[model samples]
Target chain A: MLLLQCPWCGDRSEEEFACGGEGDIVRPLVPEELDDRAWGDYVFMRRNEKGIHFERWRHAHGCGRWFNVARSTVTHEILASYQVGDDRPELPE
Target chain B: MSRARHEPLAHLALAAAGETTGPDAGVTLQAAPYQPAVILRGESGNAAFLEAFRAGMGFDLPLAANHVNSHAGATALWLGPSEWLVQSTTGQAEHGRLAAALTGHRHAIIDHGDGQQIIRVSGPRARDVLSKLCPLDLEGPDLAPGRCARSILARCSILLHPLPGGGYHIHVGRSFADYVWRLLADAGLEFGVAIGGAG
Candidate 1:
């Protein structure tokens, strides 16, 4: 089990967590404003990066809050877990 | 609202029966008989109400406050979303007073005195058992005291905290109390451990 540090609840277990997909995808404020292709792309498209990736997660079993996670896709080693509006995780040095 | 009639939890009582470690059996139940925690449950968008309730308590116990309360021999752990668990010393009468103060704050208070059983696990192998059940990593400086999180334990949702004594406190649902206890006991047996009342 990985120790996940929730920006709010501090560090909790992986068991109480649910992995959401890649993060930083901004949806259109109004659905009608976007074309069918844009809407589809926004909803379904994701980078799914292999190196450093940004993702969304919820403490489903714990606080039930959604947050963002940055980690290495190849190794699944979490670089950092922060609040949604907090700074995004950058590629490690 | 008037206080609900005090009714013993039949489910917990039944589960307590299968305990074999007690004086007469293989299980022991350290019943926390006092109505210690006055739980306040409500719908969303009540941040103002919650703030008011917090103010009324004369101390800030915000759900996400990250503040740890160290009382006489007890510890107060803050759980997720909008919950806080207040563990009391032997004769702390503050629970009732706090409950009375929080009434009519636009939240419903339920007596969780008998609703939960605080299970503590400690030892070098303590983290090993938790690693199998919880998804969070418990290693090095990551899982240290004053740190807490809400997560699933043994398929049931719970709040886990790394205590000052290098152990963990699993705050589970009243319904799943027995299931978690059994899981912990069975897991602990491999380490030549025993489960009984807290210090």
Candidate 2:
């Protein structure tokens, strides 16, 4: 059971949250505007970086806020966490 | 007020605090010092009632329904299948008006504004404190505020409200209030943090 820090709710058990996955991924603004290849690129493509990855998460149980996290894909080690609007967080090395 | 299944321990703690127990228990009260809370049970179509209540109370806090919706400012917690705990620090009198507004909507409203206590825990080691009591995964960005959930802390069920300021707003039943307080004090030992009551 991994205890997660809510930044807002202080710290809580992981049971209260829902993992969104590799943060900073944006969906195409208009599905119809893009060609099938471009849409596929947006939907199925990713850097798939190994060391540090940016992920999105939602507080499903507490304040209900959505935020981003920088974590290690290999070890699930969180390097850092930040809110969505926090100065345009960069991908950690 | 209505028993919510998502966090059984939390309601159980409320029962223990309210001294209303047993299997048939429905609504339980938890006291909040200085600040009073109103627990509302809305029947079908009570969403409108909630909106009306918010409007009637002059609530401009920009409520968010935790467990139901995750936004910010204020939010409602899903207590049971049909009940919710509309939490806000505004005022009880205003809450009373909100409750009164939902009177005949097939909902049971209880003023739980004084049966629980609110405490905040923050700093880097905040998550470590909760791990001592709860059994959930709290890694990545999953536990941020605007996110709320329920769990047991020190054998008492608690409602956790994430604060955007790198802290948590914890609500525990009044009976175990002191116990939780003591536990937090001990938990914050390494951080040399301070535990103070919320107004």
Candidate 3:
């Protein structure tokens, strides 16, 4: 089982958390300015990076806080974790 | 409001509780009597909030994550940075006191005892049975009374509290009560399980 360290609840198993697909997506201020493709892109596109990916996770069963996590898709290694409003940590090159 | 007499597991029979029964059973499971419980929410960073809470409740709000602090009849469990689960430590209703204390503060308090149950699991094998489904390392030196965490037990979300006397109190949703009890009973079969009634 994958162990996740919640920003508020500390380290816990993956079972107690829910993966919120992507993080930091901002909606267009003016929807009328966007075409169908642009709107579709905003709705459907995701980076799905090969290495480190930034995503949101909710401690569903634990403290019930949502936070950010940097993880390697290939290794399933969580590189860093921080609170929702906090800045992302500086990752190694 | 007067405390209502409602037990979710009242229908479960003790004879079917376990295969082994003795005073030395590894795990002794029972449904604890109902008590007043509430979920309190407020900004921990606000000094006014903290001061008001401490002055009114007679105890300081536990700021550390996963920490629990208690007074004579009330215990505050930190659920999040801004949230807590507070309940009566005695049989007396404590919610009224809670509601009265935070009267004008910018805070929120809601009853948590609605259809929720605290299953008491004690004995030498308490930790073992809990570890069967819980993911945390229960053997760490920091483990003590008032140490608690929210975790999954048999795939059901539960709030686990390890008491001072080596017993465990698991707060579970009413619907998942039977499943958790059966899972604990089944897991403790090899070690010996003793089922008792509410006290």
Name the best candidate (by lDDT): 3
Model 3 agreement with the true structure over B111-151: per-residue lDDT tens digits: 87866888999988889999898887788743567678888
lDDT, candidate 2, residue A54? Answer: 77
Scored by CA lDDT, what does every candidate get? 0.64, 0.60, 0.84
Give per-residue CA lDDT, model 1, range A32-64, as digits (tens): 989989998999988878898888899787667
- On residues B1-199, what C-alpha lDDT tens digit does candidate 1 reach at each position? 8895443334445334544443333222232333355454543357666555455454545444444554454445565455666655554545665566566666555566567655667656678778777666677554578767666777887767677866777766676777886787676555544344432
Tell me the tens digit of each residue's lDDT in model 3 across A1-93.
677879877788898999998887778999899999999989999998998999999999988889999988999988888998888899986
| TM-score ranking, high to low | 3, 1, 2
Clashing pairs in 3: none
- Per-residue lDDT, model 1, residue A60, is 80
For candidate 3, the per-residue lDDT at A12 reads 80
TM-score of 1: 0.63
* Candidate 2 residue-wise lDDT at A82: 76
**Which candidate number maximizes TM-score?**
3
Q: RMSD of model 3, in Å? A: 2.3
Please provide, for model 2 over A1-93, each residue's C-alpha lDDT reduced to its tens digit, 9 standing for 90 to 100: 555666555465667678887777777777899998998888888888898877777766555668877777788776666778775456545
